[model samples]
Each structure stands twice: as C-alpha cells, then as structure tokens.
Target: MARSIKNPKKAKRKNKGSKKGDGSSSSNSVPSLPVKVWQPGVDKIEEGEELQCDPSAYNSLHAFHIGWPCLSFDVVRDSLGLIRTDFPHTVYCVAGTQAEKASWNSIGIFKISNISGKRRDLVPPKATDNESDMDSDSSDSDEDGEVQNGGSAAPVFQLRKVLHEGCVNRIRAMPQNPHISASWADTGHVQVWDFSSHLNALAESETEVSRGASTVSNQTPLVKFSGHKDEGYAIDWSPLVSGRLVSGDCKNSIHLWEPTSGTTWIIDTNPFLGHAASVEDLQWSPTEVDVFASCSVDGNIAVWDIRLGKAPAASIKAHNADVNVLSWNGLASCMLASGSDDGTFSIRDLRLLKDGDSVVAHFEYHKHPITSIEWSPHEASTLAVSSSDNQLTVWDLSLERDEEEEAEFKAKTREQVNAPSDLPPQLLFVHQGQKDLKELHWHSQIPGMLMSTAADGFNILMPSNIETALPSNDA
Candidate 1:
C-alpha cells in the first residue's frame, strides 16, 4: 500500500488542552475547531484553484492525429504503475478511427515523468497508420532532436498505434496484472490482451511508429467474448478478485465472466438482467467480490450479489432522469456516487438504503448532463465530476463538514426520504476552459492529481495543496 498522506496536526497541538462538546474539560477533549498555524515546513489549510494545461508544451498528443476528426474515445491511467516498479506512470487512450480505420486505430500509450508540481502532459506515443508507408523502416534523420521538413524529426508528439477492428468503448486494466487489459468495442467484441512486450517495445524505441498490428505480435484477444445485441459500453474488472468480470449493454442486460481454466474464460451466455431500460453504467463494489452495482436509463441504481442470486441485494431510484454514470467509493465502505442526465450528482450511503434515506449529499450545480464521476483513491471523501457543460468539479465532501450540517441532513431526511440538507459537498476546485468534456481520472499514485479530456484537448489538473488537504483521522 502507498504511504498515507497526513495533514499537519499543528492545529490539534495548539488546542491540546481543550473542552469537549459534552461540557467536560477534565479529559482535554478536542475543541470544536483546531488552531491555525502557518509554518515553514508544514502546508496550511489552503483552497486550490484550477490550472489549465498546455498539451504541446508538456509532450502530449494534439487533439487531431492524422487530420481534424471527431472521434468518440476513452482515457484511463494505468494503475499498474503503483504495483509494478518497471512500468512508468502511463495512460492508455483509445480513439475511434473513422479516418484511419483502413490502416489502424491509435491506442496511444503516454509516459508521465513527474506529477507533483504544475501538471505537465505525458510523453504520448508517436504513431503513423501504415507500416509500409514509413519513409525509413529502421532509421531516423535526427538523433539529437532536430527539426526537418517543417516538423521535428519525430513531430511534436507521436502515439504508439494499437490496432482493433472497431471503435473501442472502454478499457479496464487488471488491478494485479501490469501487462493485461480487457477492452470492449462498438463492433460487439470484448478482448483480453497481454500488453507487456508491446508496451516494453514502445517504451524502448523513440521512433517506432507502427508496432501494434493485427498480423504481427500477440494482438489477438487472449480470450474473446461476443458483443452485445445493441450498444455495449459498460465493463469492469473486480478489484477484489483476479478474473471476475462484468459487462453491461444498451439492452438492459449484464453478464458475468470468470476464468475457468488455463487460458480459458467462461462467459455466461445468459445475462444477470434486471433493469427496465438500458444499463447505462456498472461498478463493482470496492470491498466486496461478489457484489456489484448498476445504474440505468430507468433512473434507478441496483446493487447485486452474485453469491445470493440474480436478484438485487439493494435498490434505489437515484435520479429523475437517466443515471449516466456512477463510481463506487474505494476508500470508504458503503458509499456510492452517481450522476444523471438531469444535471445532478448524488452520493449515497448503502447502509441507509433499507431505511429509505440513502442519499447523503447531492448537488445540481451542473446545468448540463454529467458524463463521468470518479472517487479519489487517496482520499475517501474527495471525488471529481465532469459534464456536458465542458467543466469539471473536484469536491471534498469532508471539508468544513461539522456535526451541525450532518445533523440537519438527518433531520431533513425525516421529512422526505432521500432529501438531504442544504449544505452540499464543498467544492475544492472547479476546472473550466474546455468544451464538451468527456472523461476525468485521478492519478493512481498521486493524491491530488487528475486528468481530463475534452473537445479542445486534454488538461492535467494538480492542486497546489493536495498533499495536506485531508486530515489523517477525522475528529
């Protein structure tokens, strides 16, 4: 496990001899508020502002690859960097190849060096569609980084091109395996591929443009699952289990697959179906191996336990409109976050589900439909949300949340089920300056770092005070 970042306890030290809310002073109970201290070594309680990133300057890919093209894509940072020492912190980006379809689609692998300071772009791979079309098969004009023919010897940036048949909807990498990933495509196909050799080769060479091809290398899906009847976008690998996988489609159905033998994966033909409308998204519980949750166009969120049966373990109507996306809180048990087309995002406590008071906090701050939501791995109460409004909001649910606010929320829930108090989760940072934002993900290794993609380009946002933002133990 990574070292837990601890906020300085200078505040607690200052108020060491304090009285408790119980009206007792003998025990030296902590006061309502801790003292404030500004020291040379310790970071103070400072609010962070969003910083826009320049892709070209930080060695990231341009919005367009071959030429200007509109492509539906997915972006995921490889969590393998945390467990594997040799693998650098990298991102796997898959974009639809409408223009470059005949040749190959680009699955760009970017290597990021440092993530502490002003966020810089990773080194996106160098890519050209065709192999034979290469001017020099194994040679380069400039060895010491020179410009030629109105382009740098290798252009500003190039991506390692991985070829697939159709458009890739999502890519879920294995939590334990650094070199394996499962990808679902618009062509109704699911593929599991070992990316070790290819990624190593891509990392070694500075000028190899076309390394990933169908004919060469182990480009085939080690195990392949057929596509859904309609659109198949949702897929996830269980973090608690090695090969337990779940996939959802647009037809209100979901399937679970488990590896049966060596190199053989047994996929259930019959889905664990329950949703009224299309299953929009799915998230495996961070703590439970057999338990998973799904959000649908029907505006309901349902939790299922495969060990118990196909029926839902718990269910709740999460939104008035379609629940577009959701995330299972990794750091805290029993917490789930979801976003809807009604331009509202909510966080719910599963323990309160049976009591009909599941919604703990909600915000209608976005005027457009939310596209993505992700809980921060480093902090339990922190999360990031992106919407069609082309903006991203990073929320710290623990910020300034006193007993009064929580008590009011409980009181409000008594009047109406799922009705939370007026106090919304505090906004730690808001990111604008992008159009039609698609996806946002936290850096697996760093506490306060995140990456987002949009119509214009990708932006890497890092708050200045992420190191000491969340206190180690809440009072």
Candidate 2:
C-alpha cells in the first residue's frame, strides 16, 4: 500500500475550511442555504464580474498538474476494497498525454495520496456579527489553525513516465490486470504496455518524485497493431472476460482482441461494419459476456454480439448529431447512457428496446459538445458527465421534481442562490474549475469520489451532498 505524507513541495494547494449549517432545510434547524448555482451557457456575467466557487459544495477538493494536457485517462483499481469511506484516500491512475509535439508525449502512471478533507459533513456553529473581532483577537492562525481545527491535510503526488511515439488519443487499463493497458495513438496505431515496474517503483518509494523527461532504454510496447486505416477514439476492455478487448476506428471499422498469451493479443482482420460514419466510442455490456455497444458519428447506436458475427444484432438512430460517448450502468445492467456532439444525453432501457422508443430520460443541459460520460459504479441511478463547455455535472435519475419541496427550498434559499426555474431538478452538482473539460471517471473503490482531466489540470474531488452507502465495518 502507498503511504500518506504531508503537503508536497511541488504541489500547489487550494483548500478551504468548513462553514456553518447542515445540508438541509428542516424547520427546526436554521435552513441551510443551497449551493450557489451557475450554468456555463445559461448564465451571463457582467463586465469585470467573475464566477466564484462555492466551497460548501465540496467535501474534499484537490487539484494538481502533470505538466501536459491529457484528453483521456482511467482510474486504476487498487488492492483497496470496493467500499472505502476513509479520509486521506489514495488512488492510482494511468493517463496518456497530448503533448505539443508528438515526440514529447508519454504514458503517465500516477500515485496520488493523502487526499484529506471533509468540509460538507462538518457542522460548525453560526458565526456571530463579532466574527471580525474574533479573527483579530485570534493568536493561533495560519498553519496552527489547520492543526488546531482538525482540517483536512493536503495531498501528495508521485509520478512515472513511459515514452510514446505519438500523441495518445485514448487510453484504458485492463480491469482484470491494471498493469496491462492499451492506448490509441494519433498515428492510427493501438499499443499495449505493462506498467508493473512503474507501479512497483511508486509503491516502494518513500518520498515524492516527479519525473518529466525520464526514460528507460529499450522501453517498448508489449504488442502493437496498425490495422486501423484511420485514427480513432473508441476502445474498451471487456469486464466479463479477462483479456477480451474491443476497438473501433474513424473509418467505421471495429475489431476484437483475444488474449493469446499473458502479454500478447490477436486481433482478427475482419472488422465489424455497422455504421456509415466514424465510430466514436465503444462500451462492453456489464451483464452480458458476449454483448457490447458502439456509438457512431452517423448518429446511431449499435448492439453487437460477437457470437452473432460481424453485423450488429440490433441498431437504433440514437441522436440527431454525432454520438460521442457511451456508458453502461454496471449496477443496473438494463440502463445505457449515450452522449452526443449536440450537447444532449439520453438514457435508454435495454429491456424496452422496441420500435425506437427505449429512451427513458433525456437532458439538454450542456450547450457544448459532450466529451465524456460514465455511470457511477456505486449508485444505480447516478452518473457524471463532462463537456467542452468546461463543466462537469452529476445527475441522479432517481430524483423527481416535487412541487411542495421545491417551493419550500426556494423560499429559504432565495436570498442565497438565485437559480433559474428551468434547471433540471435531477441535476445534483456542477463542478466548474477546469477549462476544456475532456473526460471524467468515478473511483470504484471510493464512493462519491470523481477525477476529471481538462486543459488546465486534473481535479480529484468528492461532493459533500451526494449520498453513497458505505458498507458497515463489521461486514
């Protein structure tokens, strides 16, 4: 296990303390104000007026930079069990970078630890009007305030890099063996690598180490395939099977990979042909071993059963514009989520697929293209979405608009948060710190923990209000 440490020198921290009021509008307790809401496209800002983040909306938030911008990344599952509610959490991740030059790109393996803080759960007493006097009279402040008040400790990061030939468009780690990973490069090649050495080095290192230009001699991929005529962004490793993989390309070609040996895979030449335009994304069904899903730029979603041959078993015209991403709900296997280039996302029930009426819910909240989407592994009705508009949103399908509750909430919070009535009631949280938000993933081991990558940097956060069931300690 990776050890936790104090604030790292290379890391820049932006941590805020907790405020008063519980996250409720009950009659007895002073009604807690709702988090201030800001929509990227819907809300307009006046000259010299900038948007500020509501610290009360976050339980624990931390940001770090990896020197280069990354378009896609995967959270590497660690030895930690599925239900982890402990503070000061540690996580491992693998990301491929889009460097300024092709030769500058590399595969980064990260060990981010000591992510401590829980602001949302704390309930301090309401500060009186004499708060200013209290601040002036306080002798112990600064670093002493954190230690005396029991604030969350800052996080630390350690990284290792592996040189790559071209810019990585997308990357994924095998669910069965996280050390074995795959990357799709701009050069129209898919390569697989083993990061066991890097993982071991990070695990054993006692201090933080950030290697930007470090390289090992003869560092080569375990296997490489150049069968795709065009570069692609769609790739997924099947969770049901150990080494079963599916990849699709811009030429509307899809291929399957089967593990031949421990570190080798064989991809068949005959590709699955079901779309007229570019294949945008691919996802393997959570429940079915032989079933998978694919979305295309032609605005169609196809369900493929490998046993049924190259043709898709069923297909549907999912969107008016290009469908960019797909995320299958692992808890509720019947639900499938798709994000489109038109900034709308819809959820469909696989069981109700008949005559093109399978859509159960649709939302057009995002004004820019939807860049990434994923269903939370911990909650059946929860999912997260990222868009080019530089916002990441969390939604709960289980929530519905309650007129009386909404009225009561608005009455109490009207003075604090002036949100538009048109905003969806199901929308739970909106995180807006990064620029050109590209992708986001929920940590399977830690409930409510989310990591997102964008043009600015990476954000690892846990919303204070999102409810997640943590297993009992005795269990």
Candidate 3:
C-alpha cells in the first residue's frame, strides 16, 4: 500500500506505475542486456491520451497523483574533484508540486540515494535484440546510453518541501561549495540554501520517500533576494565566483546578488536591464568571475561585467528566433553558445559582440526547438545540445576541418552573411533514446560523462565517442 501524506488532492484512479531504478554498472565486461543510444535513470515522461472509459468520450482526463511531480532539480555530483565510480551514490534536485491545490510557491529538495546494485534478472527486456550489441560496442567513456520502461533499477529518492511563495523556474547547484545552492521562482525571489547540514542529517536515516512525499526541511533558506517581479525563468550561480549569483525574470529584469556585511545578502538596488523581452537564461563565464552572459526572447544576447556598473558591457542581435538559452565555454572565457526556439544553435566569440556578425559556427541539426547547450568542461572544444525532439548530440568542435571550411567559418563569423552550406564534419555522436529531455549536464569529474532529466525521468549518461569527445593527444 502507498504510504499516506498530508493535505493534497485525494483521488483514487486505477492507474499504473513502474518500479524505481538503481543506476549502476554491469559486472561483466560486456553486459548482456540490450541498450539504447541513451541511458535514463528514471523516466516520468507523461504521454497524454484522451481516454473513453464510458460512452461519453468527450471528457478528456489527465493523470492524477497526490505526489509532488518533479518541476526541476540539480545534481549534487558537481562538487569539485568528485570521483566517478560504480559504487553506491546519491543525487538531488529542486522540485515543486504541479498540483493545482498546492501553492505554486512550494519548492522541495529531492534526494535519490543508494544508486547501486542492479537487479539484472528482474530488469525488463529491451526494444530490440541488437541493443545489447550496441551497448557492448560503445566506448564506456562516451555514454550514448539507453533506458527501458520496466528494466533499470532506480535510486530511492527522499524529499523535503519548503515555502517559496511562487512557482520555481530553476535550481542551481554551487560548483565551488557543494553545500551551497540557489533557486529562482515566480515570486520574483532568489533564495540561497546550504544543504550540507541537511544531507548530513539524513545520512543515517533511510529517508527515501515516495516521488513527491518529500520530507520538509526543518531549516529555512539561508538567504533570499526579492528584487524582481513577475515569474523568473533564469538563475545561475557562478562557478568561479564565491557567493556570486545572477537571476532573471519575466519582467525583463536581472538582479545580481552578493554577500553582504554580517549574515545577510543583498541584491543591487538597480537591476541590469536591456533585453526587450523576458530573459530566458544566464550563464557566468567559467574562467571569469564578474563576466556573464544572458539570452532573451528579444532575439539577442548580452554580456555583462558587474564591475562596469549596470549597463550591459556588450550586446548583439544573435538569432532570428528567440534565444532561449546560452552557456559559456568552460575552457574559453570569451567563447559562448546559444540555442533558439527555432531549432538552431550557434557558437560565437564574445570578443566580437559589438560586431553584427559574431557567430563562429552555426548548427541546424534538430528539427525540433532547442532546449539547452553545454560545453565540455574537460574538452574546451566539445559541445552538447539537447532538443525538444528527445535527442542529444555531442559534437567535437576540434575535429579537423578542411582549409576551405575553416576559411568559410571565419568569413561567416566576420561578415555575418552567407550561412555555411554544410555543418563541418565535427559531429561525433547522436543520442535518441529519451523523450522530452528537459536538461543535461556533464559529470563534474568525468571528462565525457553526462546526465540528463526528461519529462519521462532523469538519466546519468554520456556519449560513446570518448576519443573524439575530449581533447585528443594530437589536438
């Protein structure tokens, strides 16, 4: 029987769910189970269908659950120097209830622990027999993993609910300090949290609660910033900057927060504002602390240097479509990549932001809209792009392109005209095993390893071309 929970929409629908997965490695050098191109930890991808139980087929129904469905979450594995192993491990994500009766403000810290021990025998079968062969042949360094509905064992997750006063749009884990993190929500609030203590407290208790019945944190957020209004969609913590944060909202407002005297935190009285529409995402340069980049529905991207005061240090019209997301290259301070709603992504040099033509490379691979992009922290030239079509592709930007191609790349980035006739053959691997992927991130320590979460569930994975996915010995 399912354990009972506190106040929520109570409904008894004869529904079905699957067992959790224990994300682990196989003992045999080449496991026998069939594998797909992508490996997912737990998939909660909801496939909607209008049902007709009775004759009145006009009533469209939706899946109902008392549990707080996952809205968003962050990986705890980003702690610097984290070692990758098949040993038991744990991870966490920030979550919020999608239920109508619940406060849009209720945010939860969700945990999945003991991600070890695979039940190979009980694991569900694969979509095809060749799947196992594909798994055995792929390089371990590159994940290019896969998932099945009834097979993989999932980590047990525990959760704690907290009050945010509005809907949460994003949660970011602090890379410098494993215990510190922050969230941006509809309440126009940026809340900072220190989770070390909470994690320590649950070390002894097997606190794996059901998907949504998360345990409430006894402590409150360490700090909160309430400078913006309306719903906020972007919030990013600087990897190199200690206690530095940047958050954006639907109000077209962006606030930079810093640690203040005593025990408090403060947001600049004036927000950095320039975008004509809602800011979709923001990222801090991995190599520069004060420098960061922001994308917006205004079809532009702007770079800011906090030291330069409130104005954008440089800005450029980046796309014909809304620039939904942008990320800085981990190895190059001035290198940036942006994804748009029109199913395209571009790579550019921030040094040429003032120039109308700044895109160094443009990729039109996904037929569906783009979601997010990340450069490999280990390989300065590698890029990963996720899309709405349930696919992930890792490209090796360092691949040897012909002199003519190189010349054309520079020409396009310089002149901002004549789109490239073809994508340089830097393409490495393509992953098509998951549906509705929401986000993707690389392992902190592992060079090519990656993790992604979808509406179906979350996945711990990477691509298969480990050799090309990283900086080669010859590169």
- lDDT against the true structure, each candidate: 0.57, 0.77, 0.59
Please give, for residues 1-475, the per-residue lDDT of candidate 1 as tens digits. Answer: 0001122111100100000111001111345533221111122234431122321122111122222121234444454444221212244443433333534443444333321122211222345766424523322222211112223223223354456666555666666664567776667777776666665754555542422232322266687787467656678888887878898887887988887753567888878877988887789999888899999888999999998777677778899999988899998978999999877999999989889989999898777888889999888988989888656777888877576865674375332212223424476554444555666777665455566655444555454334345322223
Name the candidate, 1 or 2, with the larger TM-score value: 2
Candidate 2 residue spans exceeding 4 A from truth: 1-39, 119-152, 211-218, 407-415, 468-475
Q: Which ten residues in a row have the lowest lDDT in candidate 3?
A: 52-61
Error of 1 at 188 (Å): 2.1
Ranking by lDDT: 2, 3, 1
**TM-score of each model, in listed order:** 0.67, 0.86, 0.69
Which runs of model 1 end up more than 4 angstroms from their true locations?
1-104, 114-158, 205-218, 401-425, 470-475
Better of 1 and 3 by lDDT: 3
Instruction: Write model 3 residue lDDT over 118-157, tens digit each, in one string.
Output: 1122212443768765543431111212221123344455
What is the full ranking by TM-score, best candidate first? 2, 3, 1
The backbone clash count of each candidate, in order, is 6, 0, 28
In angstroms, give how far residue 13 of model 2 lies from its true place: 12
TM value for model 1: 0.67
